[model samples]
Target chain A: AQRVTQPEKLLSVFKGAPVELKCNYSYSGSPELFWYVQYSRQRLQLLLRHISRESIKGFTADLNKGETSFHLKKPFAQEEDSAMYYCALSADRGSTLGRLYFGRGTQLTVWP
Target chain B: DARVTQTPRDKVTEMGQEVTMRCQPILGHNTVFWYRQTMMQGLELLAYFRNRAPLDDSGMPKDRFSAEMPDATLATLKIQPSEPRDSAVYFCASGTGTGTNNEQFFGPGTRLTVL
Candidate 1:
Protein backbone atom coordinates (compact mmCIF):
# COMPACT_ATOMS: atom_id res chain seq x y z
CA ALA A 1 0.00 0.00 0.00
CA GLN A 2 1.16 3.54 -0.71
CA ARG A 3 1.03 5.94 2.19
CA VAL A 4 2.34 9.34 3.29
CA THR A 5 2.95 10.06 6.92
CA GLN A 6 3.28 13.48 8.52
CA PRO A 7 4.16 12.78 12.11
CA GLU A 8 3.55 16.22 13.61
CA LYS A 9 0.10 17.67 13.80
CA LEU A 10 1.38 21.08 14.85
CA LEU A 11 4.83 22.66 14.59
CA SER A 12 5.48 25.97 16.28
CA VAL A 13 8.45 28.23 15.51
CA PHE A 14 9.38 31.86 15.99
CA LYS A 15 10.23 34.21 13.18
CA GLY A 16 13.78 33.92 11.80
CA ALA A 17 14.06 30.38 13.14
CA PRO A 18 14.59 27.41 10.91
CA VAL A 19 11.63 25.08 10.38
CA GLU A 20 11.37 21.50 9.24
CA LEU A 21 8.21 19.50 8.62
CA LYS A 22 8.86 15.79 8.55
CA CYS A 23 7.26 13.44 6.02
CA ASN A 24 7.81 9.74 5.39
CA TYR A 25 6.37 7.48 2.74
CA SER A 26 5.89 3.80 1.95
CA TYR A 27 5.80 2.75 -1.67
CA SER A 28 7.15 -0.08 -3.72
CA GLY A 29 8.10 1.86 -6.84
CA SER A 30 9.60 5.24 -7.60
CA PRO A 31 7.48 7.89 -5.96
CA GLU A 32 6.71 11.49 -6.90
CA LEU A 33 6.48 13.68 -3.85
CA PHE A 34 4.80 17.06 -3.42
CA TRP A 35 4.01 19.58 -0.72
CA TYR A 36 0.69 21.37 -0.76
CA VAL A 37 -0.15 24.31 1.47
CA GLN A 38 -3.49 25.72 2.51
CA TYR A 39 -3.61 29.19 3.97
CA SER A 40 -6.46 30.68 5.93
CA ARG A 41 -9.29 31.73 3.59
CA GLN A 42 -7.32 30.46 0.58
CA ARG A 43 -7.53 27.41 -1.62
CA LEU A 44 -5.11 24.53 -1.40
CA GLN A 45 -2.18 25.00 -3.77
CA LEU A 46 1.01 23.30 -4.67
CA LEU A 47 4.06 24.51 -2.80
CA LEU A 48 6.77 22.43 -4.40
CA ARG A 49 7.49 19.13 -6.12
CA HIS A 50 10.60 17.07 -5.76
CA ILE A 51 11.00 16.80 -9.51
CA SER A 52 11.00 20.54 -9.98
CA ARG A 53 13.70 21.03 -7.35
CA GLU A 54 12.53 24.60 -7.04
CA SER A 55 11.98 26.48 -3.81
CA ILE A 56 8.76 28.37 -3.41
CA LYS A 57 8.14 30.97 -0.70
CA GLY A 58 11.54 30.26 0.82
CA PHE A 59 10.64 26.58 1.35
CA THR A 60 12.45 23.56 -0.04
CA ALA A 61 11.96 19.80 0.18
CA ASP A 62 14.38 17.11 -0.78
CA LEU A 63 13.38 13.53 -1.46
CA ASN A 64 15.63 11.02 0.25
CA LYS A 65 15.09 7.69 -1.45
CA GLY A 66 17.15 5.65 1.00
CA GLU A 67 15.32 7.08 4.00
CA THR A 68 11.91 7.15 2.25
CA SER A 69 11.43 10.69 3.42
CA PHE A 70 10.71 14.06 1.78
CA HIS A 71 10.96 16.64 4.51
CA LEU A 72 10.05 20.31 3.90
CA LYS A 73 12.51 22.86 5.22
CA LYS A 74 12.96 26.61 5.41
CA PRO A 75 16.00 28.58 6.49
CA PHE A 76 14.04 31.36 8.17
CA ALA A 77 10.41 31.06 9.08
CA GLN A 78 8.09 34.02 8.63
CA GLU A 79 4.76 34.78 10.27
CA GLU A 80 3.03 34.65 6.88
CA ASP A 81 4.36 31.13 6.33
CA SER A 82 2.02 29.72 8.97
CA ALA A 83 -0.48 27.39 7.38
CA MET A 84 -1.58 23.77 6.96
CA TYR A 85 0.85 21.70 4.92
CA TYR A 86 0.23 18.30 3.39
CA CYS A 87 2.65 15.83 1.85
CA ALA A 88 1.36 13.84 -1.10
CA LEU A 89 2.59 11.01 -3.30
CA SER A 90 1.46 10.51 -6.85
CA ALA A 91 0.11 7.14 -7.99
CA ASP A 92 2.59 7.16 -10.93
CA ARG A 93 1.18 3.90 -12.30
CA GLY A 94 2.25 4.95 -15.85
CA SER A 95 0.02 7.89 -16.65
CA THR A 96 -0.35 11.39 -15.30
CA LEU A 97 -3.47 11.55 -13.16
CA GLY A 98 -4.75 13.01 -9.92
CA ARG A 99 -5.03 9.99 -7.61
CA LEU A 100 -2.66 11.31 -4.97
CA TYR A 101 -2.23 9.79 -1.52
CA PHE A 102 -1.99 12.54 1.07
CA GLY A 103 -0.73 12.59 4.64
CA ARG A 104 -2.73 13.74 7.65
CA GLY A 105 -1.08 17.18 7.33
CA THR A 106 0.99 19.35 9.69
CA GLN A 107 -0.01 22.79 10.86
CA LEU A 108 2.98 25.15 10.99
CA THR A 109 2.71 28.20 13.22
CA VAL A 110 5.33 30.89 12.74
CA TRP A 111 4.96 33.41 15.53
CA PRO A 112 6.52 36.83 15.55
CA ASP B 1 -5.38 32.57 -13.74
CA ALA B 2 -7.30 29.36 -14.47
CA ARG B 3 -8.76 27.49 -11.54
CA VAL B 4 -11.23 24.73 -10.70
CA THR B 5 -14.62 25.88 -9.39
CA GLN B 6 -17.17 24.15 -7.14
CA THR B 7 -20.74 24.96 -6.26
CA PRO B 8 -22.51 25.40 -2.90
CA ARG B 9 -19.60 26.49 -0.75
CA ASP B 10 -21.43 25.10 2.28
CA LYS B 11 -24.44 22.82 2.79
CA VAL B 12 -26.29 21.50 5.83
CA THR B 13 -28.85 18.75 5.50
CA GLU B 14 -30.53 16.11 7.60
CA MET B 15 -29.66 12.44 7.50
CA GLY B 16 -31.06 10.36 4.63
CA GLN B 17 -31.17 13.42 2.42
CA GLU B 18 -29.59 13.52 -0.97
CA VAL B 19 -26.59 15.75 -1.56
CA THR B 20 -25.11 16.75 -4.88
CA MET B 21 -21.89 18.67 -5.39
CA ARG B 22 -20.78 20.08 -8.70
CA CYS B 23 -17.41 21.03 -10.11
CA GLN B 24 -16.18 22.84 -13.18
CA PRO B 25 -12.67 22.05 -14.14
CA ILE B 26 -10.32 24.62 -15.49
CA LEU B 27 -10.60 25.03 -19.23
CA GLY B 28 -8.46 22.57 -21.22
CA HIS B 29 -7.79 20.30 -18.27
CA ASN B 30 -8.46 16.68 -19.10
CA THR B 31 -8.42 15.13 -15.65
CA VAL B 32 -10.81 15.86 -12.81
CA PHE B 33 -10.62 14.49 -9.28
CA TRP B 34 -12.89 14.35 -6.27
CA TYR B 35 -11.48 14.24 -2.78
CA ARG B 36 -13.00 14.21 0.69
CA GLN B 37 -11.26 15.80 3.65
CA THR B 38 -11.94 15.52 7.38
CA MET B 39 -10.04 16.24 10.54
CA MET B 40 -9.63 12.55 11.25
CA GLN B 41 -9.21 11.06 7.77
CA GLY B 42 -7.25 13.93 6.29
CA LEU B 43 -7.83 13.66 2.54
CA GLU B 44 -9.05 10.69 0.50
CA LEU B 45 -9.56 10.42 -3.21
CA LEU B 46 -13.10 9.31 -4.03
CA ALA B 47 -13.09 9.28 -7.81
CA TYR B 48 -11.49 10.68 -10.93
CA PHE B 49 -12.28 11.15 -14.59
CA ARG B 50 -10.10 11.49 -17.65
CA ASN B 51 -11.30 12.91 -20.91
CA ARG B 52 -14.83 13.08 -19.49
CA ALA B 53 -14.76 9.36 -18.74
CA PRO B 54 -14.48 7.82 -15.35
CA LEU B 55 -11.18 5.99 -15.04
CA ASP B 56 -11.54 4.91 -11.42
CA ASP B 57 -14.14 5.13 -8.69
CA SER B 58 -12.90 2.30 -6.49
CA GLY B 59 -12.33 4.65 -3.56
CA MET B 60 -15.93 5.79 -3.49
CA PRO B 61 -18.76 3.94 -1.73
CA LYS B 62 -20.69 2.17 -4.47
CA ASP B 63 -23.96 1.85 -2.60
CA ARG B 64 -24.70 5.55 -2.13
CA PHE B 65 -21.98 7.53 -3.84
CA SER B 66 -21.87 8.17 -7.58
CA ALA B 67 -19.52 10.38 -9.59
CA GLU B 68 -20.00 11.48 -13.16
CA MET B 69 -18.57 13.86 -15.67
CA PRO B 70 -21.35 15.16 -17.89
CA ASP B 71 -18.81 16.79 -20.18
CA ALA B 72 -15.27 18.02 -20.30
CA THR B 73 -16.13 21.06 -18.25
CA LEU B 74 -18.55 19.71 -15.65
CA ALA B 75 -18.17 16.96 -13.06
CA THR B 76 -20.54 15.96 -10.33
CA LEU B 77 -20.46 13.84 -7.18
CA LYS B 78 -23.75 12.78 -5.67
CA ILE B 79 -24.43 11.02 -2.41
CA GLN B 80 -27.87 9.60 -1.86
CA PRO B 81 -29.20 9.02 1.65
CA SER B 82 -26.31 10.81 3.23
CA GLU B 83 -25.33 9.97 6.79
CA PRO B 84 -23.73 11.97 9.55
CA ARG B 85 -20.47 10.18 9.01
CA ASP B 86 -20.40 11.47 5.45
CA SER B 87 -20.01 15.05 6.54
CA ALA B 88 -16.76 16.52 5.29
CA VAL B 89 -15.24 19.00 2.88
CA TYR B 90 -15.28 17.89 -0.75
CA PHE B 91 -12.56 19.22 -3.01
CA CYS B 92 -12.41 19.14 -6.79
CA ALA B 93 -9.18 19.38 -8.69
CA SER B 94 -8.09 19.55 -12.32
CA GLY B 95 -4.94 18.71 -14.15
CA THR B 96 -3.58 18.31 -17.68
CA GLY B 97 -2.81 14.61 -17.20
CA THR B 98 0.42 14.88 -19.12
CA GLY B 99 4.16 15.23 -18.58
CA THR B 100 6.28 14.16 -15.61
CA ASN B 101 5.04 16.52 -12.93
CA ASN B 102 1.35 16.94 -13.56
CA GLU B 103 0.37 19.08 -10.63
CA GLN B 104 -3.32 19.51 -9.84
CA PHE B 105 -5.14 22.78 -9.24
CA PHE B 106 -7.73 22.59 -6.49
CA GLY B 107 -10.96 24.47 -6.00
CA PRO B 108 -12.13 26.24 -2.88
CA GLY B 109 -14.04 23.10 -1.79
CA THR B 110 -17.55 22.49 -0.52
CA ARG B 111 -18.22 21.97 3.18
CA LEU B 112 -21.02 19.46 3.76
CA THR B 113 -22.66 18.90 7.09
CA VAL B 114 -25.07 16.11 7.84
CA LEU B 115 -27.36 16.40 10.83
Candidate 2:
Protein backbone atom coordinates (compact mmCIF):
# COMPACT_ATOMS: atom_id res chain seq x y z
CA ALA A 1 0.00 0.00 0.00
CA GLN A 2 1.14 3.57 -0.74
CA ARG A 3 1.45 5.81 2.29
CA VAL A 4 2.91 9.16 3.29
CA THR A 5 4.09 9.65 6.84
CA GLN A 6 4.69 12.92 8.64
CA PRO A 7 5.88 11.76 12.03
CA GLU A 8 5.69 15.07 13.85
CA LYS A 9 2.31 16.47 14.69
CA LEU A 10 3.84 19.67 16.02
CA LEU A 11 7.22 21.27 15.34
CA SER A 12 8.26 24.42 17.14
CA VAL A 13 11.19 26.61 16.21
CA PHE A 14 12.48 30.02 17.16
CA LYS A 15 12.46 32.76 14.56
CA GLY A 16 15.53 32.81 12.28
CA ALA A 17 16.30 29.21 13.16
CA PRO A 18 16.45 26.47 10.58
CA VAL A 19 13.38 24.29 10.25
CA GLU A 20 12.85 20.84 8.89
CA LEU A 21 9.55 19.04 8.49
CA LYS A 22 10.14 15.36 7.94
CA CYS A 23 8.16 13.36 5.40
CA ASN A 24 8.58 9.81 4.25
CA TYR A 25 6.69 7.65 1.85
CA SER A 26 6.28 3.98 1.04
CA TYR A 27 5.53 3.24 -2.57
CA SER A 28 6.43 0.49 -4.99
CA GLY A 29 6.82 2.76 -8.04
CA SER A 30 7.95 6.23 -8.85
CA PRO A 31 5.89 8.80 -6.96
CA GLU A 32 5.20 12.50 -7.36
CA LEU A 33 5.73 14.27 -4.07
CA PHE A 34 4.28 17.63 -3.02
CA TRP A 35 4.06 19.86 0.03
CA TYR A 36 0.82 21.66 0.69
CA VAL A 37 0.43 24.38 3.31
CA GLN A 38 -2.64 25.74 5.03
CA TYR A 39 -2.30 28.95 6.96
CA SER A 40 -4.75 30.18 9.55
CA ARG A 41 -8.09 31.08 7.95
CA GLN A 42 -6.68 30.42 4.50
CA ARG A 43 -7.32 27.66 2.03
CA LEU A 44 -4.80 24.93 1.37
CA GLN A 45 -2.26 25.69 -1.32
CA LEU A 46 0.69 23.99 -2.86
CA LEU A 47 4.00 25.03 -1.36
CA LEU A 48 6.27 23.11 -3.70
CA ARG A 49 6.70 19.91 -5.65
CA HIS A 50 9.70 17.66 -5.92
CA ILE A 51 9.40 17.54 -9.68
CA SER A 52 9.90 21.29 -9.92
CA ARG A 53 13.12 21.14 -7.94
CA GLU A 54 12.50 24.73 -6.87
CA SER A 55 11.96 26.50 -3.60
CA ILE A 56 8.84 28.38 -2.57
CA LYS A 57 8.80 30.96 0.22
CA GLY A 58 12.42 30.06 0.91
CA PHE A 59 11.46 26.44 1.53
CA THR A 60 12.96 23.50 -0.38
CA ALA A 61 12.37 19.78 -0.42
CA ASP A 62 14.51 17.16 -2.08
CA LEU A 63 13.11 13.80 -3.04
CA ASN A 64 15.39 11.04 -1.80
CA LYS A 65 14.32 7.87 -3.53
CA GLY A 66 16.80 5.67 -1.70
CA GLU A 67 15.57 6.91 1.64
CA THR A 68 11.98 7.22 0.51
CA SER A 69 11.88 10.74 1.91
CA PHE A 70 10.98 14.28 0.77
CA HIS A 71 11.62 16.39 3.83
CA LEU A 72 10.78 20.08 3.62
CA LYS A 73 13.44 22.46 4.87
CA LYS A 74 14.05 26.17 5.30
CA PRO A 75 17.24 27.97 6.16
CA PHE A 76 15.54 30.53 8.39
CA ALA A 77 12.13 30.14 9.85
CA GLN A 78 9.83 33.14 9.89
CA GLU A 79 6.72 33.83 11.95
CA GLU A 80 4.67 33.96 8.76
CA ASP A 81 5.90 30.48 7.85
CA SER A 82 3.96 28.93 10.68
CA ALA A 83 1.18 26.81 9.29
CA MET A 84 -0.10 23.27 8.81
CA TYR A 85 1.96 21.38 6.26
CA TYR A 86 1.03 18.15 4.53
CA CYS A 87 3.12 15.82 2.44
CA ALA A 88 1.34 14.17 -0.43
CA LEU A 89 2.14 11.47 -2.99
CA SER A 90 0.59 10.53 -6.26
CA ALA A 91 1.23 7.48 -8.39
CA ASP A 92 -0.16 7.16 -11.85
CA ARG A 93 -2.14 3.96 -12.27
CA GLY A 94 -5.44 3.04 -13.77
CA SER A 95 -8.36 4.09 -11.56
CA THR A 96 -5.96 5.82 -9.19
CA LEU A 97 -4.80 8.50 -11.59
CA GLY A 98 -5.08 12.06 -10.27
CA ARG A 99 -5.60 10.76 -6.76
CA LEU A 100 -3.40 12.12 -4.00
CA TYR A 101 -2.41 10.32 -0.80
CA PHE A 102 -1.76 12.81 2.00
CA GLY A 103 0.07 12.45 5.27
CA ARG A 104 -1.44 13.31 8.63
CA GLY A 105 0.27 16.75 8.49
CA THR A 106 2.55 18.74 10.77
CA GLN A 107 1.78 22.00 12.51
CA LEU A 108 4.84 24.22 12.43
CA THR A 109 5.06 27.05 14.95
CA VAL A 110 7.68 29.79 14.70
CA TRP A 111 8.05 31.58 18.00
CA PRO A 112 9.40 35.07 17.91
CA ASP B 1 -7.33 33.90 -11.47
CA ALA B 2 -8.77 30.45 -12.00
CA ARG B 3 -9.74 28.44 -8.96
CA VAL B 4 -12.02 25.62 -7.89
CA THR B 5 -15.20 26.77 -6.11
CA GLN B 6 -17.43 24.96 -3.66
CA THR B 7 -20.88 25.82 -2.33
CA PRO B 8 -22.14 26.09 1.26
CA ARG B 9 -19.04 27.13 3.14
CA ASP B 10 -20.62 25.72 6.31
CA LYS B 11 -23.47 23.36 7.10
CA VAL B 12 -25.00 22.02 10.30
CA THR B 13 -27.41 19.13 10.17
CA GLU B 14 -28.80 16.38 12.32
CA MET B 15 -28.06 12.71 12.01
CA GLY B 16 -29.87 10.75 9.30
CA GLN B 17 -30.24 13.93 7.27
CA GLU B 18 -29.16 14.22 3.67
CA VAL B 19 -26.17 16.40 2.79
CA THR B 20 -25.12 17.55 -0.62
CA MET B 21 -21.95 19.42 -1.45
CA ARG B 22 -21.20 20.96 -4.83
CA CYS B 23 -18.03 21.92 -6.63
CA GLN B 24 -17.19 23.87 -9.75
CA PRO B 25 -13.81 23.06 -11.16
CA ILE B 26 -11.56 25.66 -12.63
CA LEU B 27 -12.32 26.27 -16.24
CA GLY B 28 -10.53 23.86 -18.61
CA HIS B 29 -9.42 21.52 -15.85
CA ASN B 30 -9.87 17.90 -16.88
CA THR B 31 -9.95 16.25 -13.50
CA VAL B 32 -11.98 16.92 -10.34
CA PHE B 33 -11.40 15.35 -6.94
CA TRP B 34 -13.36 15.14 -3.69
CA TYR B 35 -11.57 14.82 -0.37
CA ARG B 36 -12.64 14.63 3.24
CA GLN B 37 -10.48 16.37 5.81
CA THR B 38 -10.50 15.73 9.53
CA MET B 39 -8.16 16.21 12.43
CA MET B 40 -7.78 12.49 12.92
CA GLN B 41 -7.87 11.13 9.38
CA GLY B 42 -6.19 14.08 7.70
CA LEU B 43 -7.18 14.13 4.07
CA GLU B 44 -8.76 11.18 2.28
CA LEU B 45 -9.85 11.09 -1.31
CA LEU B 46 -13.53 10.28 -1.61
CA ALA B 47 -13.96 10.23 -5.37
CA TYR B 48 -12.76 11.72 -8.62
CA PHE B 49 -13.92 12.31 -12.15
CA ARG B 50 -12.01 12.68 -15.39
CA ASN B 51 -13.51 14.32 -18.44
CA ARG B 52 -16.84 14.32 -16.63
CA ALA B 53 -16.76 10.56 -16.24
CA PRO B 54 -16.63 8.65 -13.00
CA LEU B 55 -13.15 7.19 -12.89
CA ASP B 56 -12.98 5.89 -9.35
CA ASP B 57 -15.14 6.08 -6.25
CA SER B 58 -13.57 3.29 -4.26
CA GLY B 59 -12.59 5.71 -1.51
CA MET B 60 -16.22 6.64 -0.83
CA PRO B 61 -18.77 4.66 1.11
CA LYS B 62 -21.03 3.02 -1.46
CA ASP B 63 -24.06 2.56 0.74
CA ARG B 64 -24.70 6.25 1.45
CA PHE B 65 -22.19 8.28 -0.52
CA SER B 66 -22.51 9.08 -4.20
CA ALA B 67 -20.43 11.36 -6.38
CA GLU B 68 -21.26 12.65 -9.80
CA MET B 69 -20.13 15.17 -12.34
CA PRO B 70 -23.13 16.57 -14.11
CA ASP B 71 -20.88 18.30 -16.61
CA ALA B 72 -17.36 19.47 -17.10
CA THR B 73 -17.87 22.42 -14.80
CA LEU B 74 -19.97 20.94 -12.01
CA ALA B 75 -19.33 18.04 -9.64
CA THR B 76 -21.37 16.93 -6.70
CA LEU B 77 -20.92 14.67 -3.68
CA LYS B 78 -24.02 13.60 -1.84
CA ILE B 79 -24.31 11.72 1.42
CA GLN B 80 -27.70 10.34 2.36
CA PRO B 81 -28.53 9.62 5.96
CA SER B 82 -25.41 11.31 7.21
CA GLU B 83 -24.01 10.26 10.57
CA PRO B 84 -22.03 12.11 13.21
CA ARG B 85 -18.94 10.27 12.11
CA ASP B 86 -19.35 11.79 8.67
CA SER B 87 -18.78 15.34 9.89
CA ALA B 88 -15.69 16.83 8.31
CA VAL B 89 -14.49 19.43 5.87
CA TYR B 90 -15.00 18.41 2.25
CA PHE B 91 -12.54 19.78 -0.24
CA CYS B 92 -12.79 19.85 -4.01
CA ALA B 93 -9.80 20.12 -6.24
CA SER B 94 -9.13 20.46 -9.95
CA GLY B 95 -6.16 19.53 -12.06
CA THR B 96 -5.03 19.29 -15.64
CA GLY B 97 -4.39 15.53 -15.31
CA THR B 98 -1.39 15.70 -17.63
CA GLY B 99 1.57 13.57 -16.70
CA THR B 100 4.17 15.39 -14.59
CA ASN B 101 1.96 18.51 -14.45
CA ASN B 102 -0.86 17.19 -12.36
CA GLU B 103 -0.83 19.83 -9.63
CA GLN B 104 -4.21 20.18 -8.01
CA PHE B 105 -5.87 23.48 -7.09
CA PHE B 106 -8.08 23.14 -4.06
CA GLY B 107 -11.23 25.04 -3.20
CA PRO B 108 -12.16 26.77 0.03
CA GLY B 109 -13.86 23.57 1.28
CA THR B 110 -17.19 22.98 2.96
CA ARG B 111 -17.31 22.52 6.72
CA LEU B 112 -19.98 20.08 7.80
CA THR B 113 -21.21 19.32 11.30
CA VAL B 114 -23.53 16.47 12.17
CA LEU B 115 -25.49 16.51 15.39
Predicted structure with the largest TM-score when compared to the true one: 2
DockQ by candidate, in order: 0.58, 0.67
Check candidate 2 and list the clashing pairs.
none
> TM-scores, in order shown?
0.94, 0.95
lDDT by candidate, in order shown: 0.90, 0.91
* Per-residue C-alpha lDDT of model 2 across residues A1-112, encoded as one tens digit per residue: 8899999999999999999999999988789999999997567899998999998999999999999999999999999999999999987776677778899999999999
Q: What is the lDDT of residue A111 in candidate 1?
A: 94
Q: Which stretches of candidate 2 lie over 4 Å from their true place?
A: none
lDDT score of residue A42 within candidate 1: 67
- Chain B structural similarity (TM-score) per candidate: 0.96, 0.97
**What is the alpha-carbon interface RMSD for each candidate?**
2.3, 1.5
Once model 2 is optimally superposed onto the true structure by TM-score, how far is the C-alpha of residue B88 displaced, in angstroms?
A: 1.0
